[model samples]
Target: MEVNLIVETLKFLVLGMSTVFMFLALMVVVLELQAKIIMKYFPPPKENSLVSNSTQELFQKGNFSVVAAIAASIRSYKKKSK
Candidate 1:
């Protein structure tokens, strides 16, 4: 009876550890997939590109480049989340 109890406890401990590891691995995979999808759909464009050229002009005139600043912030936030 003593031997049986020890074996059963070991089995349960292994099962629980494996389940926890599987969940952690699944979460990592999901996060990677989400990042890939987002990057593919909403890629960051060049700083000198048309979208940013206008913002650049505004900056030269002493105006805050709100759009560029916001995009940079969002990109940094996502990167940090990973």
Candidate 2:
């Protein structure tokens, strides 16, 4: 009886573990398939150089206030960390 109980317990453990592993593997496969399908149907937008160029032009045309604010914020963050 003792031997039989241990054998049954090990069988149950293997079956439970295998079921969980299979479920997780299936979930990963399904998610990958969904991502591929979405990408195929609805692709991401391309980056526009014109937009970036305009932003650079604005910075080049005397936008030191924004730059100064960013530097001040970074300096304050560094001081807080120290």
In model 1, the runs with Cα more than 4 Å from the true position are 1-3, 43-82
Kindly report which residue stretches of model 2 are placed more than 4 angstroms away from their true locations once superposed: 1-3, 53-82
- How do all models score by TM-score? 0.46, 0.51
Worst 10 residues of 1 by lDDT: 46-55
Task: Give the per-residue lDDT of model 2 (tens digit) for 1-82.
Answer: 3579888899999999999999999999999999999899998776543444343555686767766776798899999999
Question: lDDT (CA) for every model shown?
Answer: 0.82, 0.81
TM-score of 1: 0.46
Full-model lDDT, candidate 1: 0.82
Candidate 1 per-residue C-alpha lDDT over 1-82 given as tens digits, one digit per residue, 9 for 90 to 100? 3579888899999999999999999999999999999899988885655554465677785657575786798899999999
Question: What is the alpha-carbon lDDT of model 2 when measured against the actual structure?
Answer: 0.81
